[model samples]
Target: MAQKNETNSAKDQSNASVDQYLAKDPERLARNLARALEELGKAAAAWTEAREKGETGDVTTAPLIDMVRTFSRVSEYWLGDPTRALEAQTRLFAEFMGIWANAIRRMSEDAAADYAAPPAADKRFQDPEWGRNAFFSFLKQAYVVTSRWAADLVEGAEGLDETTRHKARFYVDQVSQALSPSNFLLTNPELFRETMASDGENLVRGMRMLAEDIAAGKGELKLRQSDASKFKVGENIAMTPGKVIARSRLVEVIQYKPVTKQVLKRPLLVVPPWINKFYILDLNPKRSFIRWAVEQGHTVFVISWVNPDERHGMLDWADYIEEGIRFALDAIEDATGERSVNAMGYCVGGTLLAASLALMAAEGDKRIASATLLTTQVDFTHAGDLKVFVDEEQIQALDKAMSGRGYLEANRMATAFNMLRAGDLIWPYVVNNYLRGRAPLPFDLLYWNSDSTRLGAANHSYYLRNCYLENNLSRGRAVLHGKPIRLEDVTIPIFNLATREDHIAPAKSVFMGSRFFGGPVEFVLAGSGHIAGVINAPDLGKYQYWTGAKPEGMLENWLPGAKENPGSWWPYWHAWIEKQDNRSVPARKLGGRRKTLGDAPGEYVRTRA
Candidate 1:
């Protein structure tokens, strides 16, 4: 576990920006500030030198000029929204004073313990010192108030793209996370107590963890928060009874052992995202979507994607279509002798599914009986904050980083996504792991998150360029199977599920993407983030979901017609899917007549990123 933590730490360093790591260190803060000044001085000197030399030729001043211009633009934006900026600032200042006054009064009244009831999800307040001492509690409250104010400012910033505003808010959250009193050595009261009790051994361990991360060149700024050893393929996590009926270089098609005497005649093939393990859908006996589908009297088959490395780096988006979806179809056909199957996809897999369906439609193929897209974006125009990292500069830097690496590392991608909600995701771990010197939480989701997969360079690059940067897929500009494929040509009935709190694939964006589908579509809005929204089972009875037949207009127009449903949308989905089917047949074994390629999870899932 220690070795894995160190390995992950190193991966995190490589994944995140150097400034992000450096900002965590107190001693380095001044040094970095000085360094920034020195760079500005050099830029100024260069400009002055060029001017004095009467050089008509262009100089390397664009970066400095752009920086100044950006500052001016931001200043203008704030000035334009003066009322918003002023109101937020005023509220922040008022809250800061209000917190201190309340803390003082409570302490005097011997009610300091009440500070534990924080106004926000502030972990610092959970510390004993914060609850016992007015000083520490005040500082914690002050920080929270200030952070909210800054975030509000960003949210109300004028003359910026929605994404740019989000980017600003991202930095504000990161800064708040970084400035937490709990992350530092001296400011953190728990660290001081640990220092005296353990004779500095605890401090040494914290330093070692940080050092391991730095040396490993991975930017895991937070504790992993999950023990990977506890979860294994076909044991604890993906325990659904199944057998790999077909295998290829990039995928394994698993036809699950049926639980009923009769099953839906049409097989359901799940195409999960290659960016992560397929086992997310088959997490455990209770949480496994695959197991539930089988229990629903449906023949379930899932595509277990390979964790790509340099060996598979040359594989592209088109390769995923041919080797991933097409092969899975062939395997299901070979097993059931069925000409058509209901296909489902999650996240990027859904995007790929849409692309493949478009190409198939163009070629007059009728293999898919129905399609289900879970939190996917076929149209990138409204792709949410993820687009901030999709531009030329970021993509070029990623290309250089992945040049000889063969594939995009897990931490690199994970770190970026985690940063979108740094306050919720990153800061709590900084307090828990580094400051408290605690072990990772036994969280199944965190375990799955840490157990990330590699994205093939050719494939990921193609996806980013074609889908994200170019928006070619929606425009019918993307070429697949030597033909121009468009999303509008995809006529299969589609069920679109989007999570309300999914910063990764925003619900509105998913709603917008569903409109491009040529098929009759149904868009459902579930409460939660990307993973939780889809993995939610009916038994859990958690999170509300709203349903609407896919609309011709935007999400705003669709809301009036939509109806709300409590608990998991899984049952609702099953009912909708049943309508798309024709007949029922006797349940089949894992391998009735054709030989089984391997076991449930198969070998491809075991391959590490």
Candidate 2:
């Protein structure tokens, strides 16, 4: 009788809190709801206007159809055998029963339940109310239970091919993430409290922001990840002093001003991926790798790729190699009077550099003394979730879509990348901006992420076919400029860096590629994801890295014997570079012989997508 009275008292307290929130501003709530509806109507109209103007493409249901077909195989495997189907159903039922019993026991004893709990790393259920409130606790546990059951079903499904199974798993995860209870208003306690406290005013503001973003996107929803207005390429972000020494249709070469009196004889050339601007390597003085390298007494030249448009649609791989890499090499030689230089590439830039090096080797040209590939993949065999979108059908569809525009739209690629980590990148922004009516905090990395670039049609198609689909680069089947080039032919010493938690280029894929290089390859594994892992500064003293014997065997085996070192890999790389060639020469000024086009951060990088 005492326990029952206690439970009733708790229920009364919850009801009183809800009543207080609802009754505080009834008139204001009604007014705000009306305003929110009006703003929502405007958002719908803007979307319709953009669609009618041909700014948005027709909705494609290909992914949904593919997901359904893939899951059918899993269903067939279970449904074909009555015994297996019964077992699967019984397991789920028993789990649900356990959760229910635990909830009952918690109500009786007024203690935490032990049946089910979210992983500690899951930020979605961090609200105290999720554990304190019985209703919310039940919802969280039920969702976790069902999602795990679905995943187990996929894992247990028999006779499914590897690709089919992989697609099924990925699609299941996507669906589960999308349907998470935390994404909804009533299901999320924090959002509910905020909505009530603001008397629905939060909804009004959110609707207004939604409409503005829709109109800004011209049709599609361009999710704002950060306050982009706070950052500018030359003034605040890419502030390292430099001057543009050379320009081509595809790229502009910017030679950074040297900080030290003397510099290494072999100037460093950085080839960043054209999918984004080059400022990622020069994001402010403190975080800028360019600034750090300049301070270390090295002449640094970076290729600032132009944000391509319809005019550059026909530019192919050969064109990027010739106009981008080779043109920069010519500019470097003229400026420094150096015949040999060290080269580094990031992400897809590294892939292109690898191809260019192989081509140079084939043509008997040896200007690059050493090569460093950061988070690059020469082999796509172990490439992560990005591979899910590279089947023949999808690639052909993408080709057809690009045929009309001449280049892939920036948002399309951005959306694909966001989908890879939708829980963190997509849904959090949705809850913050659209649900809570707040703008994202200013962040340099996210600002760069939002500053996207279009991919040339020919270049993008050739890349997808040669690298992701065919796996030709590592197989020695990749042909460039009418000549098939092999990785083993180019015997330059290589420094291969792979981030441990990279989703784009898995560490294993990078480790496997080390074996393909003919010359000595030093593989170093760094902690954290792609961006933070590579841009890590030595002073910050964050994360750790590993160095092992050579990357000959599997990563799992090599890791056991590898020595773990704390902090950034920048110093380690600097040491390795010096060991390669420690000779120094007098610091060279920008534009040794060639005329300067403009100041640093170049005009090409200033062009918005």
Q: Rate the local accuracy (lDDT) of all candidates.
A: 0.76, 0.89
Candidate 2 local lDDT, residue 33? 84
Off by over 4 Å in 2: 1-12, 20-23, 58-60
Worst 10 residues of 1 by lDDT: 55-64
Could you give candidate 2's per-residue lDDT for residues 79-182 as a string of tens digits? 99999999999999999999899988887676756588889899999988888777788889989999999999999998988888888889889989988889
Task: List, residue by residue over 253-314, the lDDT tens digit for candidate 1.
Answer: 99899989999999999999998888899888888899999999989989989888788988
Clash statistics: count for each candidate: 12, 0
Those runs of model 1 whose alpha carbons end farther than 4 Å from true positions after fitting are 1-121, 152-158, 211-223
- Provide the RMSD of all predictions against the true structure, rounded to 1 decimal: 11.8, 2.0
- TM-score of each prediction: 0.81, 0.96
